[model samples]
Target: MSESTTDAATTASDDDAVAAASSSPGLSRRGLLGLALGGGVAGLAVGVGAGVAGGVALGRARAAEEAQTAYDFFGAHQAGITTPVQEHLHFASFDMMPRTDRDDLISLLQDWSYAASRITQGLEVSATGAVGGDAEEPPDDTGEAQGLPAAGLTITIGFGPSLFENEDGDRYGIADRRPQALERLPPFVGDDLDPAHSQGDLCIQACADDPQVAVHAIRNLSRIAFGRARLRWSQLGFGKTSRTTSAQATPRNLFGFKDGTANILADDAKALEQNVWVAVSDEPGWMAGGSYLVARKIAMLIETWDRVRLSEQDAIIGREKGSGAPLSGGDEFTEPKFSGTAIDANSHVRLAHPDQNDGIRILRRGFNYVDGNNELGRLAAGLFFLSYQRDPQQFIALQKRLSTDLMSEYIRHVGSGIWAVPPGAASGSYVGAGLFA
Candidate 1:
């Protein structure tokens, strides 16, 4: 939630606040008096400068709402991977533009980190976020990449500036990632979503034990950042994806049979480079800590997918059982190419198509999800695909090509979220510490 949007929330009417507090025994007389005084002062201030200043603050807050989600790599996310997570809460977010600051917006975003330091519980592993494989790499024994249970849950927020906040002023300027872009997504049914989200100077991400807690943290985080700007636009989700669960049900999306198996795995350069390469730290330069961008819709259909014969399902994804690999051979991170086209007319890449040069190759940080409950009876639930590309065009091209993937039969396109992850930084430094240059 951005400051502007949260400001738009309905507060108890002044009349109501006073009357209710006076009548109900919940709030003490002193507390009620303080509340009314604060409201009156705020109302007077808003009424007075409610034009230019208010507009700019709202604009600043709204500008922060561009949705850029990406999951953290093993080193930075999920401590003790040695222990299987009964449920994992992973969502990837990155800024569309990493270094966007019209004026002091950068400073405000930085300040948010300082203040946020007070509420968190975890060790943060920051890596330089440059992509494009700078001509160097981190030391093989750098120790910058292992044993992270001590690291803790962190809020990794990225910023994107080039994306439109609002084409016009006043009404829409307060939203980032212009609401206009949302029109492109296949309708997900709900109509209440804000067409555009412009909030905060920086995007805020919070994850924890419960999915709901993540949402709660996001809403409260506004107060810290809102001290300087407004909260206008934002979105939130909770918990690790369903596929990470032991549920076995592993619901597929609009497509079917365990989508998104090819990308995820333990860290190994040779194993994943064909898919996406993890940035190797080069000790102390731009390449210190960076990652590649991997994005794909890789759709799925739950109803039909669950019913398909296991053999057919394994073929769609090259993996033996969707542990995420190739039918030709190897487990999740093993080096198994979509090779051997002679055996099957449709190779895994022939089915998925990302291996073809024209398609985009982003670093994939996707996870599965299930919304609504038993009473509500879950609707569609599948991979919430996230990719971090040095350039958006790369990922966009990949999405276009995947339209032909065989998996499309089981998956229906819905809910598209994008984010740009900034290069990593030492814990004390702010998220976009390097981009200003």
Candidate 2:
């Protein structure tokens, strides 16, 4: 037979072999489960003890056929702020090592930007990825997410007050460029912050639909920063407490109350530009399109809250738990009647409402977190509060108003951080490139 005919016959034979293998009763459910669980080739080999090669081939084929969701990494503003709130979050704060200089910091940001862009697109960290380099050298990626989908992952970077001017003084030579609005927050009325989790030089907010996908983004980025920066503190969150888009249903907190009823939606460009984005006149031109982020780890006194009467809970929250409506009896989206008799003067909704705060509004993208049971055998659960605003003062002012709310009795503010999130990086450029320029 001619070469062309021989090639056609080989292709037909391969197709038949695949069809036969797929129909074979010997292909066990355990093998398929291992593949579905992202066990990769090795797990498939172990799962199908006698059919190692075939199992590996099957796993690869399944991975190739899997669908993935991706978000654009390059944009006017970094994602995870205005992006629709994801189901899971892996937030990490990092402090630059004492020896890392300005140049080292810049290089690390560039490398992180490249890796973030690729990983968000469902690709490996580098062209020569896990198991691709020399036999002796460490792999580029950790490979825990080897065949996993991107699952709509977004990684957002931020620079804290310490990044620009730490106690050491002007470490990055950009102290003058730091925005005046990026200062450390003043002590609030009820803050019980732990020193270990209060501040950091830099922070990464990674969000995704899958927990592993979120964890993988932070893990790989932390790995890449090994010598330059070290993890200061991290928080894992699930069950998004707020929605950034109108399409998503408002999520509930551990208290079973609908949270973020009046949150700024992503589609509200006017509200976003006026309340979230930093304009050129805001100072430090590098942050023209940026926003300030406030993260508060609010620990809920779950046992105490659970024991409270339902009527008392409703009075404190100022909303009906069942409908998330104002106590005055309107729908969830109705304007809250702060003046109504049903609403208490110190109710949470009354204090948090923009109508009560000189029309000031901030975008909320918080989540409910359950770290574990504390030493007291009580569930250490609470809201991982995240808010983005044009200025840090927005959060400070709002939080000040909340200090007197009746809900304060049920919650204690523990971990806290403030960050300046610069505008998004354009294609072929790294995040915070303008700061370096």
Candidate 3:
């Protein structure tokens, strides 16, 4: 419950003071429950009136407990990566303004980190947030999420390859420190990527149970960016396609098949260490505890897919639609039997399975998205695929293998990007500060 964090505007030695100054008083479940039981003497004094008050307090405490699903902003690794996937996502990419210097970059990070720490705790971007600021000035917060709980919100920031070096030529002077595996992903077999949505210098992944809370995080953070960084392209997603904990039931994609059944869970630290977190022995030591992020905007042809025969649909996905079990038999978690015709030779499950890919695995954290209707009256909907791994090659290999998947006939890879997710910020410091160190 300590929830230690930092202040973006100041880097003093007293981290507790800085955190207290930035954070609002959180109404935790324990605190509220204690409040319900604390009015003992006063309750006895009022007799029946006290009983009525106690009932109201107990009810409020239960509601607050259900709403208070918070995570710390400061840790060994950034939250949201392995955190149980949230119900909604507001993923945004940003580019540092032209002619920005190293100091500008550092200051921007400091400010972002400070704001993230507060907002993730269900507080505002600053102490004078929303209605607390001067009447004449714009409030630090956008105010949409006022009176809301944390709802398990998490804000994760990543550094795109362009941030280290770009067409502008080492704008921040740390070009040599760029990770070898942190380059733009090579063109895939059938990528119709839009230049506008493809890449950026930075990416922020904000997720929460409440759509408004997720949107509020990005809205306020984008506002804070102001002159330092500009929004490139953003995505709003719902119905997570993957879950990071065993407690969560596997969610389905737009195509209606259970997705991420074999996903890496938060409890699997061994798999994470082996396949997700970058090791200290790896190159570019600044990213030792960090991971690589790959995002792909896949437009699913649900209309076309919907018309296919049920048998054909099952064949394409290599799983039973109802139970999510592999065609080879057994329940959802059954190791797929690819040896027989039960599973198609070119089925999605077969091709993307780790058994066929040399044990290569990436932790998936994707979500389903819809961009309204297109001119043809078709829903511009798709799967926003997000995966994190120790190296970018893990994604590249799996994607290359899936190029031949039967499901590929109904999906198109549009927006794509790769970013280096630095480790978490320590107390009293901003994220990615070690890059400057």
Candidate 4:
């Protein structure tokens, strides 16, 4: 902790004492109030001490809990990357149906807050006390702790537009996904690409030190939360080909980066809206809170890419052969000049001839999966790419250009799926619901 934080703790201890001095039996309330108001001992010293103890306990508790849940949230020691196994799993939401009895759903949804607290990881921000649930008890309103993740594992629950409305416009949640998809999807199943966590339309992601432990915990959570054993997507990662995937559990993106950079962080709010929010917003009352486009592409051919020359490969991706930077370059964010396009006639970008002016940019979040050994006795894996946008056409534009781009020589796409990430639930509710309404 910083000196400033330590100093603050010391100061609060005096406040807590002053506040508690008045009442002995009811002092806990007085102490808490004083801390919040005067930055008292509870708020400052005792609070800081409590926080540390709490955080450590929370972390340990999460680890224990995850031992039972599948899909480890713990950090693995093998590769260079550092992220809870659960954190690496990607998530998005779609629309669903709302409850006729709003209060009941809210109560049950609020019960989920405890579960949320048990699994959310590294949550930096809280979405605001807008969370409504559990009429028996209200959820605590605080900074990052407002929801869960205090424990090692983390939970990310998404809602469709229907979450905000009742038959008369009350707040409640709903479970939803495309109708045709429900039958094929299991309640909680391992993904073809990522076998760590159980997959759900609205996933409760988790992670822990042990993979078996994590998955076990997750499986239990599935039974408790949804009341069903499980039903998940049959295949979750790269579409099957002659190659193998994650049988031994190694991680890599389709591009073959030792670690592919993630675009989860945007430049600003505008970037968030541009990069993630869908353009269409008029809810037909029934579809009121839904989103419009999900661009899913199973990045095929990274296996073939693993076999190419360093120089030949670098020219295609237009980044440092190893650094994952611009060909003309700087770091990941630097701009590359198209002027360097002539460096190699057979280069990937040269043949693709992408220009900042004409070339479209689509945000990318992808990871590589090392299936089993390939024909060469080497691990075979490719990219699992997902992008969200107001319009998927932009992604299509990039693909059209890439069709003839030099990168195509090394990459081959095998599967594609798309769906809209329905809009967030209205104030005082979580998302998903509308399909059944």
Candidate 5:
């Protein structure tokens, strides 16, 4: 997870940290060293006491280890798109409040970027946010994540089509700058989309290994938005369904089968350039290094799916139940043989394969979600499908082809959104800063 996206120096440090943490015998000595590296000395000097040095060192050492999982919030591209998938996700959508103008929009993005930078580093939204502020006034931070480590948090922000213009017209004076592909997704064949959960003027995706940390990031950012933007809808998800690096194991969705086996990994720079990141030479130069994000809230009919026979399930997925190998093939990572009837033509694997889609590919970062039981006592659970592509047409074409997918009978697309995620902010700038430039 650490090797592909980061610099060589960062990778080497991560390896050493992992090695030290794994060696049981060197734990104590290494813990103390890690503590010092992680800022434990300040605590000791501030009267933590020499007597409890060992205990304090151990605690900080664990925190330092967690820090190894952290990714820089400001980078060549947004962190969450290609960063290692975390175990939890808190995705939110927002709409600009009525009559809000260009300044409000710009300030909101600036505030969100500032807060995200601190939160990803395991700090409060501001240095004096949670508790350091005046006792008489409300705290800038919500305080739920007080003592927690960063836990690999990444907060990615994006702009929906409505941000540039809406029914009233160019609200932010950037309608001319909007990419041609940035528009509401056309209704798909089997879509049962709910308007309440569909589009937004902005979106924030907060992911972390710890649920509280993830929630906290969104909560505080939501607070910062205040009258500028209001939350449209949000979803909490867990059990990541995709992997961005080979070091990660392919995760399973709510369904029993493995998912995203052929996803674009971070190490595949060529594939990323071709299918994921936008180039400066592309139509919208502001979106260079960025990607289009499509989010679908697919609701699964658990009771029906549970009753399907095991053999039929395998046939629908085009893979073995025990191992994720292709029906015609070897192990999980083996290239699937799709030429013959060995794999069903209508199977998900066959239809969604790159070969079937004109060699097109996408980077997936999906998660499984359970929203408790419905009124009929049925489980309300499904996959929150998220994919980043260089262009919106990549997803539109894929979905058009999957309209005939056999598995569609057991699932419904209830929510949909598409956002043009801007490239990472340089120091002292905000996400989407180029739109106003």
Candidate 6:
């Protein structure tokens, strides 16, 4: 039951008594006058004050109760990918333990799937929750999110290229099922990749309107994965840099330019099918409804960018700083007029535009991150670029085209990974279940 209801029930009798006494008709006019003039007045004042306090408490409790929001865990497509982007993100990539075998990995996936489903519903990870397990043994859940709501939590999982064929060679014995487009991304120009943060065998993206809820989802999932998969790297992100739904307003990147203004919206089914989802004829059969994910941790050289002239910045981005409109003049969504305009020929938007790339497009769901000041006193901030496409080449082609863009000077790609997001699990199955079959 909601806390508001409990509070109302607890105070209902007292409120009724106050109303009854105040409304009683048996008292004489002098008695009523005396009641008003004597200590009865103060008593009534106290009663009214108590009622107001109760009402305020109940209102707050009701607001808190109503704050809890949830998303369906089971669907044709995973929740986090195409789900309207949430406010916070906790993304993690894991490497399977060497000692873990195929069966062990499969079992871990099953356990994780079940736990994720329960958690997204604002329930404990398991029925025998945080404290119900044996005292001597560690609890199944971490207990940090014990009283918290789901906050619209959604967990999406993906399989990295290395998961199929790594240095250890087909660790899980599913190398044969690896999609042709799931190979590691080719090095791009100006890439300063950190090997430690670049790749993983598996990845989970947890997102929610509440930071704690997003973190808790990853924490519990990581705990459940203890002996099976070790965390390789993780990135916490806030302030979504892109909008996947029409309901949301376009958000800005650390560069102060509106990002993803021309991004593919979730409602465009034709665009999604053409540019995002992997069709049966497009790749290995297991990836039919899935898509390829390319994650890049691009570190923005904030100190340098800040020093650039505003006009130069506008030219670099090919859009107005205030309105995000093309230099050729129009609203944010207006198509760029490449001919006879101040927009740089090598500007970011012009090169990244679909018209420039043979109508190729990708669904971008990026976020801005600030990791604190660097040792050199520069703000360590950047865009965590996450894009999904029908094929890996879509990203490769775009990156190649942008290699010479003026904006590249202000940003450096520090981490990158490419993963084949498997088709979503059926109600009774786990993610990547098709590969196992």
Best by lDDT: 3
lDDT of 4: 0.34
lDDT of 3 by residue, 1-437 (tens): 32211111122223543464255333223222222233231111100112225557777775455357777677778888888788788899999988778987887787777777777777777666778867775555668889987777888999998999888899998999899999899999879999899889999999887777888888767766666677898988888999888878999998889999999887887899899999899988989878999999999887999899988999999999989999999999889988788999899999999999999999999988888888999989999999999999999999899889999899999999999999887756778988999
- lDDT, candidate 2, equals 0.78
Candidate with better TM-score, 3 vs 6: 3
Task: Give one digit per residue, the lDDT tens place, for model 6 in 1-437.
Answer: 11110111111233332332222122223222222233211110000012225557777675454346565555566777777777788888999888778987787777666666677767766665678867775566667788887776778899998888877887889989888778888888999999998889999998877677788787777766766777888888888999988877999998898999988887788898899888888768888888888999999999889999999999999999999999999999899999876789899999999988999899998888888788898888899999999999999999999998989998999999988888776765677888899
Q: Which runs in model 4 stand beyond 4 Å of their true positions? A: 1-87, 90-118, 121-218, 224-230, 234-264, 279-304, 329-332, 343-361, 374-380, 423-428, 433-437
Using TM-score as the measure, name the better of candidate 5 and candidate 6.
5
By TM-score, the candidates rank as 3, 5, 2, 6, 1, 4
Report the Cα RMSD per candidate.
18.5, 12.6, 10.9, 15.1, 10.5, 16.5
Q: Write the candidate numbers in order of decreasing lDDT.
A: 3, 5, 2, 6, 1, 4
User: Candidate 4, residues 78-131: lDDT per residue as tens digits?
Assistant: 000112233233232222233225443333333333323222322211121214
- Per-residue error for 15 in candidate 3, Å, reads 14
Weakest ten-residue segment in model 4 by summed lDDT: 1-10
Over all chains combined, what TM-score does candidate 4 have? 0.48
Report the error of model 2 at residue 225, Å. 0.5
What is the per-residue lDDT of model 1 for residues 17-97, given as tens digits with 9 covering 90 to 100?
Answer: 233222212222222232223222211000111222555766554322211111221122212121112122433222222
lDDT scores for all predictions?
0.36, 0.78, 0.80, 0.34, 0.79, 0.76
Worst-scoring 10-residue span by lDDT in model 6? 40-49
Q: Residue 408 CA error for candidate 2 (Å)?
A: 0.4
Q: How much is 408 displaced in model 5, in angstroms?
A: 0.6
